[model samples]
Target chain A: MNHLTLALDTMGGDHGPHVTVPAALQALSVYANLHLILVGDRPTILTIMRQHRASESERLRILHAEQVVQMGDKPLHALRRLKHSSMRLALDLVANGQAHACVSAGNTGALMTMAKVVLKTLPGVDRPALVTALPTMTGDPVYLMDLGANASCDSQALFQFAVMGSVLAEQVAGKSNPRVALLNIGTEEIKGNDQVQQAARLLQSTPHINYTGYVEGDRIFSGEADVIVCDGFVGNVTLKTTEGIARLLMHQIAQSVKRNPLARCLSWLLKGRLKKLFLQMNPDHYNGASLLGLRHIVVKSHGNADELAFLRAVEEAMTEVQRQVPGKIEARLQSVLLEKSC
Target chain B: MNHLTLALDTMGGDHGPHVTVPAALQALSVYANLHLILVGDRPTILTIMRQHRASESERLRILHAEQVVQMGDKPLHALRRLKHSSMRLALDLVANGQAHACVSAGNTGALMTMAKVVLKTLPGVDRPALVTALPTMTGDPVYLMDLGANASCDSQALFQFAVMGSVLAEQVAGKSNPRVALLNIGTEEIKGNDQVQQAARLLQSTPHINYTGYVEGDRIFSGEADVIVCDGFVGNVTLKTTEGIARLLMHQIAQSVKRNPLARCLSWLLKGRLKKLFLQMNPDHYNGASLLGLRHIVVKSHGNADELAFLRAVEEAMTEVQRQVPGKIEARLQSVLLEKSC
Candidate 1:
């Protein structure tokens, strides 16, 4: 906890170094114990820092990355051809013990692939799951995974996701004995598919998990469970769908107010309150999603994250490093898997 | 087109006759040529009608049902024991020639099971998909399915959904050459699973469908594609997640406003506008989801729908009845299947 180092994929995402450079400086200023290694085109990073009237100190360093990963780069293509890309170098820094964590707002597919290839999966983890905290109505945010990290997960993989998700909820979110639930369909009707049903069976027989029975999707935001588990495909769709609906309703509210003069005048008076509420629901506010089950920490920010949102990603990485998330997850998973065998 | 008759499961939903009876009368008042047969405990329906100083007239009639399907009833159990239930009786009316369609705000599992058994699937259709209209940002609502009708779907079944969804959009929504898209995960990165890829191939090859490749969950409300197809599990989770997120933000907004006195007072001034916006986003506004691919028309309303929401179900049933959606779907599916065979 005395010293923490994080590698920033400065050439990742839509804005690349322009956003990541300022965010890295902001994070360092806030966390005096933090050290940041900017991994991108060195010239671009230096120019951005200069524009902000900033220079490198003992807490900061620049590592040049020859290439940048585009937003649309395929994972395998980036792995094979763009090995020196900023996203890849950031993970490599963590892989080689040069940094405790890596944060990127870059191409998700490329980052997931390069992180897995470079850092490798934690022992006993088949594939890493993309995990993030979802805001609830009244209680603390619930952790959800595997947000498109693995498209096709079998029952065992799903069970592993439940384990990793629970660990993150406990260690990162500080929820004790966090109740975990499998995201399944059907309210009072037919249940989920074989993969989910099998996962439920595995979780039910395990003492390592505080497994509540299956939960419907409507219960996701109700805060009835601490960690919600699903395969990458379902989780990804659900997360994106939530984003889409939030934006839709917000747009509808704004457009409706624009049509009426009296309502518009009254709304302008309450604009400050409304703006605060909108920010709370905005997807950008919750930017960092950790790629769990990896050997080391790697936090993925949104592709279009702004300076503050990118800084949120850096802070998320800091928490994971401080909590030693990977080490705790590896220990917990090994015990759970061992107990399951018995 | 001149006369449309819809059977109502008056003993369905949480409020039973209290909600359905009033909604039936309202539907009758709206459409002069519409007739409704209320299936429930005859005395309860009569008492509610008497409370309104009304009697059964030529356009409205009451039929006795021995039982009512509870919200938690399992599909197979309800199918076997609840033969004379109000939900079943309503479908029976549509199955025979007593009514053109059936509207039920009852147990979804029971309604789907009984409707499928009594009405059977259309020719060339494997199973009926639960279809609903989703609100879009700048265009007419998009048709999404299957919203939990089938737990799993193969490539062929997904192809069938695309074909059927197109018909609903074209005939009921009055959209010509409606663009069809398969719901997939991974945005600018990895693609979907084998079934989805195979379905994409089928859609691309078929001239009958205006295939628009794969669309992610975030694009559901973007108004880009008119029809989005996915398996029941995925579609169900997406729909419910949308509902959950919408409610979460609404709750957050209401709670935030309550904490500020100035905001609350001014909000009360703009109450009419805010209330209108809330009403637009409320899940109850979209009550009915049609059981597509059935031989007879069936509109399944939410189990907790109030009087007005239940009336929306009746109106949806009327639209499907007027459009003769089942026949259009059947004819279109038959041709699509034949072409596939050739």
Candidate 2:
């Protein structure tokens, strides 16, 4: 049937099997030929599988992974000690080519560490970055890279992230030479810290890139640029703050609407629209952040991600596989690495 | 009536006299003894003032200045050359005690430099920091420091920012022993870069402040902490990103509501509450980020701020005057500085 199978860490995430199981079933239903290596506490997956009457259990193979990484545990500690952990086992499946990719809604750091140790960096990648797509005001997605992958980075790393982010956007989003920007305080050439300024210089002179110069934080969601690049430290903070602020705003709107009966009636009328908006802002919709430059695909879903988010993450991996994005990124990055050596 | 006059820079912001003049008049309406020194192009301010039929023209002293600081000009270059600029003149009034504080929706960097050079830093204060209050999910505002004042900072600088942020929160928000937190990638003490880790060590052991330990960016708007401290670089990015994401989400909500007649009707009903929520997200409501550590009070309004924002900034200055927050912050910081030198 020319379909692909993915290994999912169903025991991961806050909702665990409740959400993961349903999402797995949903994904399987969408692609009749899709098989899932359900890695988790086997009993839990079977119990969840039974609820869905997933006759496709024949396609869904359950692997007994006795442990799941807690969100708070150190990544190194979790990976080094928990060899049979669900996330680790999932990565092994992908590494050994038992599955095309590994997806987890667990500890992000632990996922990165396991993937790195198991699969290793693609030929010439020095560091792998986590890249996620954010919806812009123009209704198009903007890919932001190094979103908490490496908290401290130099100019060369940022430039590489831009290259990787751009390649992914082109391959996955199907954009041709997406307009790229380095996130900064001001749009001026002279604005931002040393790393951002240095990256800007490289991007400006780089021949193959569609460099758009510096973009202020305010313009990030405006669709002013297609690819936003920054050090993992800033990108991580920016992404988290954006989510927090959205949640805070949504909560505030709910409280204000409930304060009066007239407003309450209006909220009911607008409930569907508001839900859609919330869904659009949902961390799940953009849940899967890919670890770019890895030899094999590894997508880290949010720890508290729901079924919908996990489903999207699995879909993201499938898309990556279909487009051969990882291979293309590796080739482009390898050339840069070669040039640097010369 | 211990209230004092404030010098308002009218020829500032993307939408200048149109918004600034009305906002100044609005501020004067709230405070009975309020006097405004409208520093800008005389003809423009007069025309707007006349249109508003502002009865307090006598109280509204227009100090005509011929020069203006364009947003693109370098901060140091503008501050040095544009000596008679409206923004510079406004700060001069405050520095000379002709006004208790200066307010400007002008070139932020220029205002900061001019204020620092003119007002000088409080003894034992290394640099002045810009502080703003962000609305949190708990319905109370969390005070965040160094919202783009100093780009690069040391451990001591961050520690001092925490102390200053704590004092301002307590004095202004009536928060007793405000919980202070350093923004980091992770909650662990050893998780962040060297500066963040070192800052954590000192903040955790500080006696004058109620240190709550490190908080991730997601918790900033959750109201889990009272005072959030970070370097100017991180703070600026966080603040702007919050605004950008909120705008994106709200716009998405509006678009979704218009997709169908039923949803559109409901949107209209809940429009007031939604608008109120949006207003709370307004950057201007949180305008007048104070330059703490300055010997004299210095408040910076957003360069693209409107009249409503300028009025809110005046209110912020008034709050500082009543709380005498700077004095308290200096006293605590001096003791810490003394200990360090010893």
Candidate 3:
């Protein structure tokens, strides 16, 4: 927290430099002890900065990255071919301690692959799970993990995700012994697939984790549990499904208001409150997903994130850096390991 | 259409006779050509019928089914032990040609299992997938299938779902050459698990299916495709998550309206529209899911459905019966099979 330097993948996502550069300036203004290294094409980054009436300083450095990872590029291609890409360079900066964290509004698969290749995993971890914060009705944000990280994870991988998620909930969300539940179609013992049942067994045996049993999708926002863990495939689909409903409802309100005179009159007066509700309900666009169990912090923003969203992603990275998320997860794992050995 | 009869599992849902009896009266009034067999405790059904100022007649028969499949009953237990249960009896009526279709709001697992055991699957069908109609932006409801039927499905099962879904969309939703999409994390060739990728290959090779490639969860309500197919696990979670969001948004609106005076005034004026929007947005509660690929029609209402929702389920069963959904699916499969042999 003394002085934080974070790298930005300015040549990623749909908007690229247009969003990242403005977000970088905003982050610099918010965090007095913050430094941002913009990694992208030199001319475009500089031009965007100039357009925003800003210039590079000690706290703001422009690091030229020649290649840009396209949205359609496969993970393997991004890993093997685009070595000097902005996404890769930003992750490289984090790996070598040039920055405390890295933020990207890039293709998720590419970033996941590159971050794993560059920073490697924390010791005793096989895979890094993608964890995102979701708002609950109880005024606490529940952390859901493995959001399209490992499509078909083994029981061991799910157990590890539970540990990492617990660490996140405690360190970042500031919850004590956060209750963790496995996301399943049903809550009964007879429910879920083999891997989930096996993971439930593993979680039950672990002393440090406050393992609540399985939770169905309908209970996700009920605040019955602080953290929900599942294989990446299910998690990703569930997260996006939530986002889809948010979009659907927003669209429905708009269309309905247009047709209904009474609703239209009310909509004009409650515009601000309604906009905030829509924004607050949509977590993927407003917040970022952290790749937990990595050696360094990396937050993945939505691909089509606007300036405000990308800035929120940078803030997410800064918060993870301040909380030392990876360090705490490592420590928690060691203690769990010790308990098992005893 | 000829006279249609639907066997209702009067004691299956949480509300038992309270919801089903009132709903039966409504269905009888709506469809003059319809006859209903209410299967439950005879005394209770008679009492509820009397409450509605209706008595047993040729159009409405009360079949005594003493055993009730509880909401928490296991599928195996219901299948083996609860043969006289109202859910099983209703299914039995359909099997013996006493009823054209059966409607239940019992435990989904029990209903699915008993449905297969009594009515059986279509000759070439591996499993009977759960299909539901979701309201879309195009005003025509899109069909989604395998909503917790087979938790982990092979490519073959997924392909079968696609064929059945196409038939439903064409016959029921009346969408010609209905576009079918597989639900996945990304739309790339390298994205998704082995099952989904393999399923995509199968769909691409099949001539009858208008496979539109992969679609993410966020594109579900966009009306980009007529049918979306997924394994039971992801499909079930996606659906319940949608329901969860609907609940959360409704709760938020109520809570927020209470806090803001401007919003409160708007909410008062927009009360009817808001209620309709919320009800329309929550499909699981508004509509029942049909067990596709079955020999007979079986519509599973939401467990906690009210009288209106139960009435909708009765209407859904009647629609399928009039459309001869099972027969149409049989013919479509026969044609596809003939094409394959060529």
Each prediction's TM-score versus the true structure: 0.97, 0.94, 0.97
TM-score of chain A of each: 0.96, 0.94, 0.97
RMSD, one per candidate, in order: 1.7, 2.5, 1.5
Task: Tell me the docking grade of candidate 2.
Answer: medium
Give a tens-digit lDDT track for model 2, residues B82-123.
Answer: 999998898888888888777787778888888889888877
- How large is the interface RMSD of each prediction? 1.8, 1.4, 1.1
Ranking by TM-score: 3, 1, 2
lDDT of 3 by residue, A1-342 (tens): 579999999998889999989989988988899999999999999998999899989999999999999999999999999999999999999989999999999988999999998999998799999989888888799999889999889999999999999999998889999999999989999887899999999899998999999998889999999999999999988888877777777777789899878778788887777677767766868788899999999999988899999988998888889998999999999888789789
Q: Write the per-residue lDDT of candidate 1 for residues A1-342, one digit (tens) a residue.
A: 679999999998888888889999998889989999999999889999999888988789999999988988788889999988888888888888999999999888888888888999999999999988888886588888889988889999999999999999999889899999999986332388989988888998999899997888888999999999998889989888877776776677678789888777877777776666555554434558999999999999988888999999898899898898999999999999788788
Give residue B322's error in model 2 in angstroms: 3.3
> Native contacts recovered by candidate 2, as a share?
0.76
Please identify which of the two predictions, 2 or 3, would achieve the higher DockQ against the true structure: 3
Q: Which stretches of candidate 1 lie over 4 Å from their true place?
A: A187-190, A282-287, B187-190, B282-287
